[model samples]
Target chain A: MDLHLGRITWFQGGRDKVAREEVKSLEVYETGPTLTFSMGPQHPGTGHFRMVITVVGDIVVRCDPDPGFVHRGEEKMCEYKTWITNIPHLERPAILDAAGMTYPYVLAVERLMGVEPPERAKYLRVIMAELQRICSHLYWLGLMGVFAGHATMYMWCFGDREYLVDLTQLIGGQRITHSYFVPGGVRNDAPSKVPRELVKNFRTYYRMMLGKDYPSGEVPEDFRKYVLAVCDFFDTRLDEYYPMLLDSPIFIYRTKGIGVLKREDAISLGVVGPVLRGSGVKSDTRIDEPYDAYPYIKFNVPTMDGCDSYSRMMVGYYEMKESVRIIKQAVEQMPEGPVKLKQHPVTIKVPAGEVFASAEAARGQCSFYIRSDGTDKPYRVKICSPSFRNLIAMPYLIKDVRIADIPIIYWSLNYWPVECDR
Target chain B: MSLSKAEEILKRLIEDLRSRFGDRVLEVNVEPKKIVKILVALECIKDVAQYLKSEWAIDYIKGVTGVDLSKLPNNAQEALEIIYHVGSLSSEALKGITISLSTKVSISNPVMPSLTGIWKGAEMHEREVYEMLGVSFEGHPDLRRLLLPEFWSDGPPLRKNYMVPGREGQSG
Candidate 1:
């Protein structure tokens, strides 16, 4: 009756021939009713990822998430590149929020170099990062809607996301991989006319699209007023968003109690971002370890005790509002100065030291452990991405769930394959 | 918990470890703003980990980072250092503190006790360390390659000595 009474050498190959033969002799070989199938690496539901699942009838009994389809050896490749050049490719893992992905890396390098950015540059970094967070969350929201078979939701979310993307382009000159974040600060400052342009665009958009007149032109000297006005405009748009998606009967029915992860399980599994917050753990790196302009901003860390797909989705929705608030505050309080330090990017030398820096990215806590050996390039770079940690919970959450709920639960966890595999 | 309270708890934890572990605890370096790094003998790592879990309530492991020290000229023993970044969500006092428990094993005999029994979250990270750094984690339930292909016959890619196919000219 004791399972561990004897060593199971059946998997040891030819060396365990006797044990293998004994196992074959004792067993009655009969095919089980369970169906085993490999879903993805090319499937529509899973993006460039594969998971082998064994199911009985419609319920999944076992699941194994096989990532690494997009592994480009980013960590190892960092050793060959200079401190500054690595920023562009390092953000590729989670391109939707490029600034968020590279923020921690820049922080770690700065710590090693013993230099701090100017106050203006810090606020600029915060603005760029918050914008990236909104863009990334919108992208995930669209994907979530698509996974649940709501194409209109996808169109709306993606369509709304372009405005933020345009703003990012106006500042960084690139839409996706901005390469905007550097060691001492961001690459450049916002143009002098950006505040007026933003205010005008938001007012025009609100009046034309939402049929609501946004009061503007008050306190034009403060960029924060315009940013807050835009955020207020989005607050109105979000009111239209809830009843259409979260309150829909189908959406509620499909995600209400499905793939429930308890708070303990979520913490032990190392899940982060909205998934961790949804399970009622009040842990966000942005709040816990205030970095950039996070300390100056005031916003509530949204949490839900439901621990279900719906709760996670709601967390994502509420977080977008909080990001808007943070951006507005950061813009309002930002001091005027040079956006970047006068240090040269290519020839910078960092002293021999190691530091680990973490930031709350859209998916979760993105951390970078960089070890420098008094050189321009790093000795070793270790990236612990949120998607990789959250992937550990997939096998546990997928158990006993219907096969149809697989994509819903999967996307709800926000497991970005590229980030995980990196 | 406030920063000062977290530091007090960390100091008390270190003192308790010193009393309990005696000479087995090699070094305890506390960086109040960063992390608390503790190096222990390979033989006493499991006991130290158990004490941290049961006594200090540092339950969850944030990550398991393995560094291959075989390439270093001074490390003639050719050791592999594994640092376990363990913390807790259940305990409010210990939430702010991250205890980094590290142990080193000779590369020729790279075997260490797995912490999966203590923290189930360490499963995937241990598998990754096993495959990437070639450290055999004893008592790990499923010690297979987590990221690499099954048919991968090359030496552990993360090891400093493992040369990439066409990039021999570049030095680390």
Candidate 2:
């Protein structure tokens, strides 16, 4: 019943398993119905996850996501720096989700210290969060397409994502980690033309043939025709990608019912965001726990009942639709105002208390807890990133998925290892 | 549905906690916009968390952080304190209550109970605490060096006393 396994699996100069003596003593639990395989940290499907997923023959029997690979000790560093300096430190996780990351921290600090941002500042925060949401969803779409082997979708989405990145750069002077949203408000007001430019860009890209016109019209008519013929092809592609893998007859045979997270188990594990919603729970920190402008905005939380890799993809796609709704509402109801509040002393001394702030990040619900002692610096700052929480569900989810399907399952979950480890 | 009702529910729940476990609920500090800091005796952390989650339906825990009150040493007994911010997405009442559990552990043994059992979200927070502040959790399932490679020898990166080798004496 007991077996010994050894580290250092290779022989110095040959293609032989040198740790044979170690393997002989291994306590091989009745190999169950399959062989267990570890998937990440270095695997491409995980992107930055650096997670180690164990599978029992194509089915993920367990997923142990070892994050902290990218932990830069951001919170610890925050205690030593001024409040203003900490914004950039916290925004590093998913640089694509900058608004989601920084907004909560700003809100929490603002609340604790007794400062309400100007109305203009509130509107600007709403606008920036919506823009960041679009940018993040686009990035996920690109990754989703790449995982499905639809190289075209991946390329097109990234190419479109550049526009938003440029918009971010124009506003905050940084393409990715725009530490633009400060405690009182944002760093500065956006250029007046930015909103009009946004409408123009969205109108052009979300329509027919206009997107095809980009990049010197190099795209062939056949591609354009292919895109237009399907009418709702852009929308349908989400569902289509999964079944392609599932019913390839060849591919589906490899990836059906893999990494299944039963509905009840998902909730009990406290798994959040898409992983929870993918398992049919309608839990959204944005809707359930509305913060900032979210209470005034309107959007629906999307959930799927399938509770598998397929369901995970569906959740992201449906959520993308909802994000579009949020952005539209934000833009329509956006009242003219200042983006950030009047500048105060750069070095802010927080009250001697603790504040916990959460926001609906692309990964899930990302949170930051700060404990201050009425000083310019915090006594301790802790970050509870969503990727960290969702990663725990991996071991439970990947029980019986195929080795090839590992990438599919991982991407569908939108696992960002840097955020998780951090 | 109103914000005041949420505040009332939290106060009532904390009152019940004070009755069941006296003295442990040190101070129920509420700051309207910012945070609701519930100061508690370290030993009654689980009892308080159980009340918050089960009785008040405070299901989501926003974040877990530690504050070293080395500056307020004259007024406080403990050198370091752990804080929990529990949020509820389901319950309209008790939307935000950051319950603070400050147990005075010796600077040598700055240990606290892990809340990952109730929230499942505190796993990484606890690991980070272990790595950065060198504060050990009594019941953490898997506590290992996170972020920095296991071999890096810069002791507890976040402690107020921790000094970066190259950056020493560069205080702002």
Candidate 3:
């Protein structure tokens, strides 16, 4: 409802309206009275990205986002590596959401190669993907807290994110860049050794302290309880974030009406993920075309009508809750089976065909198009990253706000620079 | 997914295009995935794009892709293939489907009309195609190098003919 349309009018040093009207061109002002400067590929706000902004008085008149600082020619590089060997570097662009990044690529390869992972592998993949979604949203929220001038929110978010990170390390066998996905299935099934060890160690400690051994087995009271408990703890923990950031007066004042992208503008620019959902669009790849275990497990795609920075942030905030619900369901309903169909040789040749695979990533929609020409190496692989698709929305929104509010609007889109340049 | 669900949507759309332009629509392919492919001649690509946007309501694009077809075995035709995968945001029935419209241009002078006039989101994608594959869009507003550095001019790196530096004779 609130549409500033890229000309914010409030400023401490307001130039006379009649005098400002005479200077019609932003380019003229750039050459004359306006200040034109390039912000960072190094500026903490625009990580690995630069933007040239021209401002007249306190209002921005023109913006040019330059985002090739982290370009590594990822698609070109994929041509050289075999399909299985490409997973590690393919996910490097979005290391925080590695599972979400490579899910579609692996699915696409599986579709082309005509192989299906076992049923349990599908559930495991969904659990890891949703866990990483919550992890990724928390990282974004922590950085956004700092951008909103609230260090406490930053500390709270990063601290809580560790629980999910630890849970992920238990299954994924790594901390951050988990190349856990393979063509037919995941790299390995969920490990019982780590959790069994933890439960066994806890049983010994409880007997020594309380003088009772109680009951124990090979499964050791099941690992599913631990995953469910984390989900329950996070359910209440995420509720706290809503009031701390969303309901607080100072936080709302900074983000509520800033960078309002109207519904029409959002659709025309082809924005995806939270940026589009925040603007009242009922579209998500997971719901529209259910992938992995999403077809079985039920979840909601949260939508907001505010069409502002606050709406985008709230959509991401609420999506984490849905992700938690999904993780709980996947763990409970998982079937017992082998993870992979069969072990193929290192050099697997896919039949000549083309496939397009898409997944709902933490940031938004990420898709991969693979064209195989009956060879181990692919003829082409095109990555359509959500950050790159959302790039147009930045210059469109940043044209009207004050210089101080730029970081608030920029971080609200949750645009990661490395992902965009890839 | 049930393949027929996607196929049902693909059938109606392909029928509409075939009826409208008889000879211009060259090829139609339905893969096992949730995608529909239509290959049109080079000249009618703009008309097909305009028709899809105005009549069929395939509003937003996923991405644009280009493939060099020079190095394929037993292939004599020299050309660069371009593909545009489109979907709808407003229409729920058509949300999951992707219709990739492809067109080919001569490898020597690969110039085609840009679709940015209709879908403004393709501006950066067109620039990227220009930078990576040397396939220029004639009517594109800002057709410059997007991700490539300013000074590099060896060749379009994505093209099959352009060998990566220090990796010559290292064919897989």
Candidate 3 local lDDT, A1-422, one digit each (tens): 01321232211122223113322321133467888887787899989988878898988988878788999989988888888888999999999999989999999999897777889999999999999999999998889889998888898888778768877888888877889989888888886544556545544544543365533323244568767766876787798898898888888999998999988888888889999999999888988888778899989999999999999999999999999999999999999889887776768888888898899888899999888888888889999999999998988999889998889999999999999999
Q: Residue B80, candidate 2: how far off, in angstroms?
A: 2.8
* Candidate 3 chain A worst ten-residue window by lDDT: A10-19
Residue A172 CA error for candidate 3 (Å)?
A: 1.1
Note the DockQ of each predicted structure: 0.42, 0.30, 0.33
What tens-digit string does per-residue lDDT give for candidate 2 at A1-422? 12222332222222113234323322232355655344445667776545444555455565555565566666656756888788887888778888888877887788777777776667567656766766777677667666666666567666566655665676577888878888887788655543445444544664543435433332223322222222232344444544543344543333346568877667556566787888887777776557767777878888888887767766776776676566556555656776666676768677776666777887787777776678787666677777767776665655555566667677666777777766
Estimate, for each residue in A268-365, the C-alpha lDDT of model 1 and write its tens digit.
Answer: 77788898999999888877777877777889999999999999999999999888888878877889898777757585788875577788888888
Compared with the true structure, all predictions reach lDDT values of 0.80, 0.64, 0.83
Best by TM-score, which number? 1
Q: After superposition, how far is residue A405 of candidate 3 from its true place, in Å?
A: 1.6
lDDT of 1 by residue, B105-146 (tens): 877778899999888888898888876777878888866656
Q: Alpha carbon lDDT of residue A92, candidate 1?
A: 92
Q: What TM value does the first chain of each candidate achieve? A: 0.89, 0.78, 0.87
RMSD in angstroms between candidate 3 and the native structure over all alpha carbons: 8.6
lDDT of 2 at A268: 50
For model 2, what is the error of residue B165's alpha carbon versus the real structure, in angstroms, after optimal superposition? Answer: 2.5
